[model samples]
Target: MAALSIGIAGAGLLGRLLAWRLAREGHRISVFDPALGSEPTFDGQQAAGYTAAGMLSPLAERDNSSAEVAALGWRSIALWRDVVAALQARPHFAAIGSLLLAHRGDASAAQRVLARLAAEASGTPRAQALSAAQLGALEPALQGAAHAWLLPGEGQIDCVATMQALHDEARGVRWHWQRTVAQVRPGELVFDGAPSQRFDLVFDVRGAGGRPALPVRGVRGELVWLQAPGHGLTRPVRLLHPRHRVYLVPRPGDVLLLGASEIESEDRSPVSLKSAVELMSAAHSVLPALAEARILRLDVNLRPALPDNEPRTEVAPGLVRINGLFRHGWLLAPALLEDALQACALTQPAEPLVAA
Candidate 1:
């Protein structure tokens, strides 16, 4: 395959991942994102990954996602590791599996989640039903969780570190940080107030920034970080609730990534008090120790999603537009990238996101 000059317009998770992948293929690559910066501020926030719990859970998402999505996630576990290994950068990856917790009153919620995951098994992984004793054995820190389901093989990643590692590894790629791309066309990219450039291929991955051109709607998501070392668990936990679902991703340095609230609107404001209180209360219910955790900060961002809440890819003569990842950015990125590569005839033949 011949290397081509490729210009990527975005600095989000997908943008950064694709940049290094293309660069490693020996292509001339340049990337731009408005929120690109050296550090994610003292508040520990970035435009994309900082607020995400980064759960790479395929089976756990079986309820609302298409079979294609579940398959894509099933593939991303290996693809993510391969992508990271190809760059030789260390990112936090915990494949110890994930937990689905439901209180005594929510036995139906836990059963429903388990049943849905079981039915999606068209070669996808399965989640094991767990008794209270089993759950306690796995995560000793969790309390007040009577019934649970252990989604085997699910995991998480530190999105911030992955991006940083990619940045350090992709030394040859040109980075145009803090630049907003106004227009993108095949072989052409027009910056907001800079000279336009031509390339062999142009990638429009601006997330919500390219909404004018791409068919993407912004879905706001918010997460709360806490300084809770002793409250940390071994893996990600998804607690089922009647109103909203809560996920807690434990990170190094005794920090807990508690998220998030999903809303239909595109509002970027701080979390509403109702949602914040609900989230905290839910967390406390799952792990009583969380009551003592110090409040760190509230993080909010909108995920680009289509009406179907599924990711998509569009390819033209010299342009490729990928978006609508929504909340599955981490779980589906590799498969979507494979689609992008297949579209460009840059990848060897492989199975579809889900075999027919």
Candidate 2:
């Protein structure tokens, strides 16, 4: 395919990933987003990706999501490895897998998760029931756990680093920062109080910003970061409960990301006191060491979702709208990129331009 002009709205995970990939394919790409550019002080709360803990657990997610999502998540994990390598930057892609824990009281919840996983016939690694000794060997930090399941091959990525690297390494692209797209149509982007811009192809990855144009609603997710020094969690750890599931992801600098609150509201307000207490309390029950951890930050962002909560791609003559990723933005992005490119009748570039 010849080099064509492409305009992408929203510089979130999907937008930036699409922009970076298409630019490498020799396309003249331009990106528009209301958020600031990739600056040293870029706030993570501005986009949903940065606020996410970046867990790529297909089996864990399969308990609540569809089979298609789980399958795509597995594929995206492999694609993410390649994309991270090509970026040549440290995004902290850890394939150490994730651990699922349940207290004696919540044993039924864990059993349901196990039953769901067993019903599905997949090529991915099966979840293994961990013995007391095995759980200790795997994650010694997790205490007071009645039962544990180890889902191998699941992983996580540093969303902040990944987004920054995508912005820094993208070539042959023009960036329009702080530009909110009001309308996205085939081959044209209309900005507020500005003239419409035309392109050979247009991608509306505006997420919740697409609003009424697309049947997308904002699903609020809350996360809390803690500075837990001397903690020894190597990978993501999820604690299953009857009401909600809490996860703790280990990050660099002796920090831990605790999250798992999903609310069906578009409110972009700060994290609620009730949610903070619930998340911290649940996480503390699993990892007693976290009780001494100091609170670092509380992040709240809205994930784009449709009524069905499944991601959909709509294609027109020269337009492609990808949205409704919900909480699976990072998990499903790479696979969805492939689907979108196929929808556009384009193939991946044989030689990508990586940062040196």
Candidate 3:
């Protein structure tokens, strides 16, 4: 097969991943983003990737996602392991699994989660019910939780570090940074206040920026990063609640990411006081150490979602659009990239998988 020239619009997580994948296949790739080239201070204009909890929890996500997504997410974990191994420098990541806990009052919620996990339509979404003793043995720091479940083989990634690794490893691709893409057409992109450039294929993974063109909505998520110093949890922990499903995913150097509040609004404002209080109160309730953790930063981002909250890949003549990753960016990216490659005729069946 001939190497095709692919034009990618959007330099967020999807764009960077797609860029590196194609470039490794010896294809000519050009990435155009409005924030990359000109930003000196790393102001995240197209940066939803930077704010995610980076949880690669396929089983944990089955309740809120379609079976197809669950399947894709399960596959992505292996792909990510390979991709990270091939990175210029590996990012801070862990596959320690996760603990899904619920207080005695929320035991019903925990049971509902268990029921949903049993009913998951795809993937080997398995979990073991945990007694308080087992839970304490798993996470000795946790307390006051009567019911819990241990999800094995799950993991978390520091997306901020992974994005940088992807960017650094994406060698030999043309970058058009700080250049706004007005319209993505078949075989070409219409730039804002500039001449249109043509390519053999176009990839639109612009997240919420692809807005009215794609039927995508922005769901607001706020995450709080804490400097835990000497008191950080060993692995990611999920606390089940009536209104919020909170996760505290740890990064390297004693940093704990406490998140997140899922609201149905696209308001791009700072974290609300009400949300901070609610998240803090819930996390502190589960992990008492968080009460004394140093406040690092509060971040708010709008995740792109379709009506079903599943990511979509559209194939057309000389064009492919991938979006609606909705809180599953890391979980679903590798499969989505493969979909894009197949859509663009870059690879076919019987091709050997790319190994690190």
Candidate 4:
């Protein structure tokens, strides 16, 4: 295949992922993102430290996502390993699966739905249903949980590390951090105060204003951190509820992350007092021991989400719009980027989207 020059906007997970993949395929790539360095903050707090950490779980997401979610997720899991491996510093990958626990009243219904969904996804890797006893045994730290669902093959990646790796791994790609692209024209990307260069393809991946048609509204998610007390569980745990779903992920430095709430509004920065109280109470309900855990930090940000919860990839001749990753940017990035690369004729795989 012939080499191509590609311009990618929005240096977040998807934009960076595509840039690295295309660069690996020998395409001349240029990346632009306003949030990369300028720290020109948005969404109330600084956007520099935010991450899309959760991976894609097909069975777990059956109620909220399309079949495309799993297919892309499986492909991403395989793709991320290679992308991460190529980096000078490999990012941490936890393939220990996700633990989803529902409250007692909602346990049976959610489990039945999850089990049926898992059975339907039999050919693909599946989420295993767990009895209360099994759930408690697997994660003894968890209490007051009536039922659980485990997606054995699903996992998570540190989004910050992955982004860093993407930039570091791009050998020839030009990255213009802190540059806000203000205009889009054929064969050229124009940053507000920078010279514009023509290219063969332009990708509009700007997070905030990238795609207007996508039912993507910003969802505010806040996470609270506490120093871990050496729990033996080696994976991420998500406690389910009707009003708020909480996830506690184990990180290095004896830190455990607790996130809850998907605040649906244009205002992305406000960390509601109501939400915070609800989160702490929910975490305490799951594990009373958490009451003693030392609070480390509180973080809040908006995750891009689509109403249908499906990623949209549109290729219109010279330009492509890739946005609406929703919450699975890390989980679906590998496959989605692979698809983009193939569409651009950068990779000559057997199932190439464009003829070489």
Candidate 5:
């Protein structure tokens, strides 16, 4: 492949990951993030600093997603494992699989969902179904949960850590932080204050770009960090319910990240009381012990959702737009990034997976 100069207009997960791959392939890459100003500062932290409930399984997501979801999800799992292996020493990552459970009344529903998941997960070993007894043994803290399903081989990483690693890994790419991108025209990349930078190809990834045709909505998720009393809760737990699903991510020491509630609100304000009440109640229902846990902090962030619940990559004459990852950003990232790179001609084809 000939060395190419690539310009990216967002430093979020998609932007950073694409830039990293392009740079590795000997592409001259210049990146600009509106979140960062002229004098870029490397916080050595992940972009957005938002909390994520990292659950990755197309089969598990079939209950709320389409067949295409699992197919794309399976394609990304191996890539994620490779990335995680390289960043193993980084903080805020746990490979402990995800748990999908249910209350007594909804046990059958959970089973049905699990069966669908298993059927779709034929080649994907990261997903499994666990009986009620097995579920209790895995998560002793989960009190009175009638039935449970386990995605035993699935895993989660600290969203913050993964983002930080990407930023740090962009050693060869030109990373411009605090730089606000205003527009993208033919052959020119526009930014605020600085002169427009020209590139052979430019990418528009401003998550919430002002494009009406792009069908993307914000699914707000909130989480609270709490310090638990015991040390045995080692794995991540997903308490599945009819109205809501909750996850408990155990950080180092006794601190456990408890979350979250998915609401269809795009407002980027502080978490509402209604959301808090709902989240706390769901957490308590999952594990009654959380009733006595001390609250550390509360966080709320919006995930870019799409009609298809999958990330879309579109290439124009000299520009490409990538977004609509929904809550499966991490789960579906590898495939999405690969698609972006290929559409932008950043990576070579491997026996031609599909048309570009």
Candidate 6:
């Protein structure tokens, strides 16, 4: 196949991943985003990928999402291994599995989740009902919790590190930072007060940024990072409640990512006080030691969702629009990448433009 000039809108997870993949296939890639940094930094938190906990739980997600999404997640897990190995970056990729815990009051809700997973023949590992002793042995930090289910093969990734490594390693790709794309047509990209640019193919993956042009709605999600001194959770843990479901993902250096608030608005404001209190309180219920943890950061971002909440791909002669990942951006990214590549008819394996 001949190399083609590919124009990608949005430098978020999907955009960066596509650039890294297509650039390696020897395509001349140009990525445009409104975010203000050429390189990923501490202050660079504009994309929704930065605010995510990056949990890759396919079985757990079956409770609310379609089986297709879960299947994509399972596939993405294997693809992530390849991506991390190729990048050689420490994104803290972990496949030790995740836990689903519920208080006595929410046992019914947790049971429903377990039943749903049990009925599906997804080929992934079946969830195991853990006894208190077993749960304690698996995660000693949650010894106080009585009900727990272990979803094997579920995992997480460090989104910030993944994005940074993608940007750093994708050689021969031009990045347009702090530039907002106005429209993406087949093989062409339009910008405000600028001339239109044409490419052999164009990919729209702006996440929530691809609004109006695409049938995408913004669903708000907020996450909080905590610096806990002695919290020893080796894997992601989901605490089930009637009102909201919160998850605690442990990162390197004793840092914990706690979040679960999903509102139906497109607000990009700072984390609200009500959400902070609810998240902190729910987190404390599961792991009491978190009460002493120091607050590190609060992040609020909008996830692009379609009406159906499942991800969709619209393919044309020289364009592909991929969006509506909802809260499963990291979980479904690699599979979506594969689908997009097929839509572009790039069947050959990608070869690196520059040797690593």
Top candidate when judged by lDDT against the true structure: 2
Candidate 2 per-residue C-alpha lDDT over 1-356 given as tens digits, one digit per residue, 9 for 90 to 100: 89999999999899889988988878999999888665523233477877889999888888878989988999899889889989867688988789999999888878888999876655778899999999999888889989998999999999989998998888877999989999999999999899999999999999988888888998888889899998999989999976566899999889999997898888888888999999999999988898789998888888999989999999889999999999898999999989889877866534443445
Candidate 2: where is the Cα deviation over 4 Å? 39-45, 349-356
Clashes of each: 0, 0, 0, 0, 5, 0
lDDT string for model 4 (167-265, tens) is: 777679888876777866666887666788788988877654554534556666777767858655567877776777667777655767777577676
lDDT of 6 by residue, 1-356 (tens): 89999999999899999998888778899999988875554332477887789999999888889889988999899888788878867577988999999888887877888889887664678999998989988898885566998989999999888999999988899999988899999999999998989999999998887878778998888888999988988999998876666999999998999996999998777888989999989889889889799999888888889999999898999889999999999999998889778767974446432346
Model 3, 5-30: lDDT tens per residue? 88999988899999988887888999
Q: What RMSD, rounded to one decimal, does every model reach?
A: 3.7, 1.9, 2.0, 3.8, 4.6, 2.1
**Residue 212 miss distance in model 4 (angstroms):** 4.5
Poorest lDDT segment (10 consecutive residues) of candidate 4 = 40-49
What lDDT does the true structure give each of the candidates? 0.81, 0.87, 0.83, 0.69, 0.68, 0.87
In model 1, the clashing pairs are none
Which runs in model 5 stand beyond 4 Å of their true positions?
Answer: 36-49, 88-96, 108-112, 115-121, 125-129, 192-194, 210-213, 229-231, 349-356
Give candidate 6 regions above 4 Å deviation: 39-45, 349-356
User: What TM-score would candidate 2 get against the native?
Assistant: 0.96
* Residue 265 miss distance in model 5 (angstroms): 2.0
Worst 10 residues of 1 by lDDT: 347-356
In angstroms, the error of model 2 at 350 is: 7.3
TM-score per candidate, chains pooled: 0.93, 0.96, 0.94, 0.87, 0.84, 0.95
Model 3 TM:
0.94
Better of 3 and 5 by TM-score: 3
lDDT of 2 at 327: 85
Worst 10 residues of 6 by lDDT: 347-356
Better of 2 and 3 by lDDT: 2
